[model samples]
Structures are given as C-alpha cells and as structure tokens.
Target: MKDHLTVVKHPLVQHKLTMMRKHDTTTGEFRRLLREISQLLAYEVTGELPMTTRRITTPMEEMDAPVLAGRKLALVSILRAGNGLLDGMLELIPSARVGFVGLYRDEETLRPVQYYFKVPTELGERLVITVDPMLATGNSSVAAIDLLKEAGARNLRFLCLLAAPEGVARMKEAHPDVPIVTAALDERLNEKGYIVPGLGDAGDRMYGTK
Candidate 1:
C-alpha cells in the first residue's frame, strides 16, 4: 500500500473490531472475533504482494495459473499478544514461515526489553510481516523492527488490530519504508501508555487477565 498506515475500513473488519472493543465482551468472544478479523486484515496486508504465473493443468486443459512470487512470506509475531493475531493469519497463509520476537516493558523504564527472538533464515529475501494486537507507545514495535533489521529483514510490514496516533507517528519516523496495516486508529494514548478508547490491554483482555 502507498500509505504508510492503512486502516482497514471494511465493514466486517469494523464491525468485528467494535465487538472486540466492547468492555462486556467475554474472552471467548474476543478471541473468536480476533481470529475472524485477522483473516480479513491479512487480506488487506497482502494486497501488494508480487505474483507470477505457474504452469498448471486443469481437468480439461493446461494453463499458467497466477501464484505468489518470490520466497514464502514470513510471519513474525511480537510475542504473547501477537500470537493471537498470528494464529489467524496462519490459517489464511498456511505456507508462510513463522518466527517470534518476545519483548516486555520494564515498569520503571517503560522501555521494551527483548527476552527472546528467533526469525526465519534468509529474511532479506522474504517479505516479513510482523504482527501485534496493539500499537500504543510504539516502543516495543520500533524495537522489534530494529531487531528484525539487524537480523537481515529488509522488506518488512507491520500489522496490528489497533494503533494510536503517537505509535503511528513513531513508526513513520523510525521505519518509513515499512508500511503499517491496522483495523482501527483510536484516540491518543493515556499516561500509562495504553491507547485511549482502545479495547484495554490486549493481552489481558484476550487472555482474561487482570
């Protein structure tokens, strides 16, 4: 997508996201909605993927069929919450290579600390799409991208369920070349680094934590 940040405004995406944002929604419902929505979001995220023709034979005739070009795409989950989004995307792109980056914010420092990271080999030659549920402060997202780049991922894209303006600006400033795809761009974040009018802590809500 040409836009640095593409908000998926499809009716199904918006409707499901709104249900996910409701305070009264149960964990089971939220998880189901996330899975359903991620499939749709995956469609938007992969819109610009390159395609090529592959020779194939039909029952009646043989012809060249269009197929994705280049190496199999890579799906990098930002750990914990990202796994939720990852699962759904995997359902749609079952052949994609998978990886994970684990990060947690230090309470006092409020900065992301990487605890675990493992990415697919030859990342530079693959289209790497990193996923997370929320983009609030963007610290962890930015840090994750930094690690991915260090690991040799040149072409990368970010996908999230919700994004704050601050996070969008932060990503634009840090990785302008990497496009961001999201279901919603909510209001500003609160002092605690949570997206305002967001669905609360994504991990907590999805996993039924406090």
Candidate 2:
C-alpha cells in the first residue's frame, strides 16, 4: 500500500487477462476467467492486511496462530460491473463484510451519479477495499471513494482489472492516499472514455448483452 499503484504481473493473472481481452471469448468463458483472475488479484491486494497472533492448540502442541487483526475487512463493490470482481473476491475472502455503491456515468458529461449507497459500520476501524473491474475516466471511482470517505472509512484501497493512465492520474490527484491495484495499465482511454485495448464493457460481456 506504500506505492500509489500496484500492477499484478503474476503469470496466471496475465494469461487469464489475455483470454478475457479476446473478442471471441464467450460470455460464460469471460465470466469464468474474470472470477479466476479476480481471486489471484485479491491475493496481491490483501497482502498488507494487519495480522495478530493468538495462542491455539494444534494436534502436535500449543502454538501462536496468526489471524487477521481487528474487525473483518470491508469489501465495497462499485455496483454493476464491480459485482463481477466482487463475486470472485468473496470466494477467496468469504468472511469479508460486503457492501455496494451504485453509480452510473452520464453519457454527455461522463460524470458519476449516485443512486444507491450501503456499507458496513465502523468503516474507520477496518480496511476498506473498493472493487471495480475498469477504471476508465476515474470519475466514478473517485466519486465512489468520496462517498466512502464521507462514511468514515480511513484506510482504503482501489482494485480493478484494467486502468487507463488518465484515470490513474485523476485518482492520484483526487485521493493520493488510496492505493490502486490493477491487473494491467493499458495505453490510454479513447475519446469516448473507454480504455483502449481493454476487453469490451465488462458488465455487458459478462451478461452477454449489447
């Protein structure tokens, strides 16, 4: 979390990402790959979680066992496409507290509009990780973080499958303290605010919709 951004270069994550980027990948296959890649990414993102040791008796003898410190970590999905990544992360961290923030971009302005918001209590006492598949314009990501902060979350991390340079910069300017973890940072965002070389709309691809 020291660095502003961390790109997971693990081989498995890269291979699965390539399959997802292919236009020919079917909806079912895309969803499967995303779930697989998401678990791998989750491993990297949770590396810094605080740990404490508790004395426990094993079959052999009593010993100190390390466990997650304090309250369970909070996982907030940025709604819709974010659920794709959220689902997989949950499989890996089943005990994590879950929440959701619903927001959509205005086609003309590309700004995020919030429609729903919910999260775990005592956000300031636990690590909060926000999951969203793509960070394109950063408008929605920043806005989501803004809302989370207002809710009292102090420790925060942003996780995504892909990121555009413009979006990364915007997030840094808006919330430099929140680190970003992504599978890959693509070349750039197109005029329409989509990441170039990124797999098409994650939500649409997962659902097999236009």
Candidate 3:
C-alpha cells in the first residue's frame, strides 16, 4: 500500500522466483531457489541498514571498510515455515539475535492464535525482522507482529517469500510502519484464501511433509 512494502524485482531474484513458480521444479530445486532468492532479498532488506567505515588490514594497504553501524539486528521466525528463509538470512547476519513465534489458525474460527513466543531480552535495542514464507490471509502475520509489539520490539520489518494483494492490504491497514520486504506479490488469493500461483505450502515443500 504505502512505501512500506518493497517488492524486490532484481533480475537474480526474479529469475530464481520464476523457477519456483514452475510446477515441475523439484523439491531440491525449489529449496535451492528459495535460498538464492532469500539471499537476493536479504541484500534489498539490508539497504537502509546503517554502516560505519572502519580501517581494514589488507595485504596491499589499510583502507576503510563499511561495517554494520547502529543497533544490531534481531530475526524472528514465524514458525515453522519461516525457518526456511531464516537459514539464508542468518548466513549473512550470523551474529544477529534470533527469536521464534508459533501461530496456527483455528479451522472453525479461521483466526490465528499464538502457541509459543520467545524473543531476545533487549528487543527494543535491536532492529527486528520477522519472517514468514507465505502471506496468505495476513491473519497470522498480523498476529505475529502484534505478539512482537507486545514483547517490546520497537523497530520492525517483515520478510516473506510470497504475498497476495489481499494480505498486503490487510497488513498495511494494520501495521503500516513495519515495512515488508518480499520476493513477489501474487495476483490474489483464491476463495480458499491461499496465494494463487503461489509455491504451495512452504512448510510442506521445505520439510518434505504433506
């Protein structure tokens, strides 16, 4: 909706995204592409991150190198699907603090309820990044963000592999300040509230389950 949602359209990300959209893409292929896409998205997500120049010792000479400045990063996974993206992101920011939240929707109520919540101690001092692979109805994402907010996380951003217009709108309406970085925004969700042409259940494909 607003400038909060940044749809990463880099060629590398787009090419890998294309592979994931193909039905014939194998599990291994899908996993690999997801990792690559995650890396590309990570670059975009870290765009605004503050960096300070520091002297580096190279064989040739000493030169100033950009190092992370400002508050450290905290990555919160919206388990268990969000774990997939966490891997690649962590490879980049290995020292970042990690957190987890578990949310499952009730079939009858179709509302999200949290089952588990754990965050770092100094959440207010860290830049929060909450990740989930799919943004279908936005119920779980919104609920997860609410949980983070309650837990005292101030600066927040969302990282997702796929998103739908409906879910995007819902999230923008709820938490416009917490920007979202995603690989692709699909057409729309179907009647069943699943992202259309979306890579099917991310959890399933990732863990080899149903």
CA shift at 35, candidate 1, in angstroms?
0.6
For candidate 1, lDDT tens digit of each residue in 1-210? 788999999999999999999999999999999999999999999998999999999999999999999999999999899999999999999999999999998867779999999999999999999999999989999999999999999999999999999999999999999999999999998888889899998898889988
Steric clash pairs (candidate 2): none
Which sequence of candidate numbers ranks them by lDDT, best first?
Answer: 2, 1, 3
The true-versus-predicted C-alpha distance at residue 24 of model 2, in Å, is 0.8
The lDDT of model 3 is 0.87
| Candidate 3 per-residue lDDT over residues 109-175, each given as its tens digit | 6688888998888888888999998998999999999988988888899999899998999899999
Q: What is residue 131's positional error in candidate 3, in angstroms?
A: 0.8
- The candidate, 1 or 3, that scores higher on TM-score is 1
After TM-score superposition, the amount by which residue 130's alpha carbon in candidate 1 deviates from its true location, in angstroms, is: 0.4
Would you list the clashing residue pairs of candidate 3?
A: none
In angstroms, give how far residue 204 of model 3 lies from its true place: 0.9
Model 1 spans > 4 angstroms off: none
lDDT, residue 150, candidate 2:
98
Least lDDT summed over 10 consecutive residues: which range in candidate 3? 104-113
Ranking by TM-score: 2, 1, 3
Assess every candidate by TM-score. Answer: 0.98, 0.99, 0.93
